[model samples]
Target: MASPSSLLSQEQIQCICLDIFTSPISTPCGHNFCMACIGGYWDSSDVCQCPLCKETFYRRPDLCINRTLKEISEQFKTRLSLFEEQYAQPGQVPCDICTGSKLRAVKSCLVCLASYCQTHLEPHQRVGTMKTHKLIEPVSNLEDRLCKKHQRVLELFCREDQTFVCVLCNETDHRTHNTVPAERECTEMKVSFL
Candidate 1:
């Protein structure tokens, strides 16, 4: 059962600033942006246009912040903080991106080789390229998780060798070895144990 905070989609709550919503204002074209972000954008532009969709407006949109969005953003923020504090207890891996006081890592990216908290994991969830990064349960010592010989994530389980292996390892030393994705091997092992 996933926790309430685990269900939060950062992609929806965030604005153009790449941060959580602050004074969320809606454009006439129905796109939402932070008040300061939109204000500065309009100030630098020659015409009033939607930053997204590129729809030009005859006149500037109202500066009023959307009360509903503001309330939702605030609620989301509160829940996020509560969740972060709860997970910050000892024995959990801390987020690599967080400074000062680090929060517990929610996911670890095999590609980035770094762990992330809920807040710091936004880019992987939102950005197209980063979305492809393989994320697994938070684990400490990410450097040790890599295959030393190949310098790649140990994402494969070499069934013949009974060891974790990497893609490059399969191409070279493990060419004849029976291997599968580490996740599949884990599931198979769990079922056998059960």
Candidate 2:
């Protein structure tokens, strides 16, 4: 497949490129423009015509989204995002799935033990099984959530030790100690602060 840059000329891309390609439409004259761009242009003028070709239409044609063009635009955007993310800032979490150019992660899944960009994170949001996984703001240190001894996610806080502990840790080392869910512990600390 031709790269997005090779598929569309620089001028064509610029003509159609708005803030982002929301709805792309193709004119009967075989030219494509963003739906809003065409609508806005026509709304201000006396005649409806292709912006590029200036081929006037006697009557306003019903515009439908150009699915193929839209798909191409989407692919272009993904490639652009990946290109941008390749130079991600020092603190940003790079997406694990992105190979050559890793995009900044929007969410980190504890179950998957992976960070994902907005595009790559869609499956986690849509899939029923993945939806139940604990998703947190992107954090570089995933190992902090795992117990060194138990190799399980540290979900509980041992009040006595003042540290995170996994379920097995509560059963073993913290058997006689006061423990609570990390969220509960955090809430209690916040209440105390207030």
Candidate 3:
């Protein structure tokens, strides 16, 4: 018998299965599966609990395409869009450091000088992992967001004295520049810049 972790990892598209099971037609959470898997793996189990996840399925399992699978597929499409935005430069080479596995680059950190796809990004935010990486989506205008020099935090807003400032900047450069809150400036700037 395959280990539970290995079982879930198998049969996933490119080993990227978020959730998958074998027997009992169940999910990792241990629901039940009959109708859903019968059409796919009927010869194996007329009634099967998810071998990968260990979920239990009730009798007379309903035959339906797995919505969970559909959702994951859609998420992959989004990842692709994010990758395009992050690597927008002409002739931008494929991510060489990432094992050449094609995944969506969903985030970038101006400070860290690194780009991360969906797979690596999650582990970066995980509790036990280092949380040093900053993440931003495509629509956040991350290209123009960095400081021309430091390239640290994005330029969020300027003070009343018109000094570009981040939250940290308030305490450093623009401390005496009649600082107005960024939220208020954002509200006003939207009308003109938008």
Candidate 4:
């Protein structure tokens, strides 16, 4: 008999919980993510890439809900809720580092790309190199911030292609395209709307 934790690992829970596990879908590459998560991700980009393996699919494949996984996930969720009420606070991201009792995350490190609770985040505050790491409010779907092709953080927006690009991407595929820091693009668009 598999333990509850073994039945659903932290990574699996993250993927399922981030998108509420509604209508779970499996890709041809054998990766599973919430249907809404993959749909929204593909809708924003030009290509269909698996969030976990970064496998690109030229055409969008037919999606079907995995009834068995869904049922198991639902059962697990019910059991977890019954085990601990108010496990995660309202509007708070759960600390990925916590094992038994997941705690609310206080900060997220961009360098490590992981959320940490107040206790686990101490190293970032105390260590010199870690102190330089950018910390922001906890965010789900950290993988979306990465470039699929280069596997680097998307920091720039390509005006010509109208998509996010990483630093390395700017030097390669988008070298000719007008590009600017993502922040600058946001600022420009906001100013234009005013």
The TM-score-based order of candidates, best leading, equals 1, 2, 4, 3
lDDT of 3 by residue, 58-143 (tens): 65344444567555544544554454465434443233236634334566655554556655566668845457655544223454
Cα RMSD to native, each candidate? 17.4, 9.3, 13.2, 20.5
Between prediction 1 and prediction 3, the one with superior lDDT is: 1
How many clashes in each structure? Answer: 0, 0, 20, 0
Q: Model 4, residue 69: what's the lDDT?
A: 71
Better of 2 and 3 by lDDT: 2
- lDDT-based ranking: 1, 2, 4, 3
lDDT of 4 by residue, 38-101 (tens): 8888899998888778899999989999897788778777766654443457666888898987
Candidate 3: where is the Cα deviation over 4 Å? Answer: 1-102, 129-133, 139-144, 148-151, 161-163, 166-169, 180-188, 191-194
lDDT of 3 at 172: 75
Among all windows of 10 consecutive residues in model 2, the one with the lowest summed lDDT is: 9-18
* List of clashing residue pairs for candidate 1: none
lDDT per residue as tens, model 1, 1-194: 23445677877878988988999999877889999999999999999998888999888877899999999899888877676574657888989998877878999998999999988999999999999999999999898879998788898999999999989999989999899999999999999999
lDDT of 2: 0.82
Compute the lDDT for candidate 1. 0.88
Model 2, residue 59: displacement in angstroms?
51
* The best candidate in terms of lDDT: 1
RMSD of 3: 13.2
Alpha carbon lDDT of each predicted model: 0.88, 0.82, 0.50, 0.80
Total backbone clashes of candidate 2, pairs 3 or more residues apart or in separate chains: 0
Q: Which candidate's TM-score is highest?
A: 1
- The model with the greater lDDT, 1 or 4, is 1
Q: Could you tell me the TM-score of candidate 4?
A: 0.50
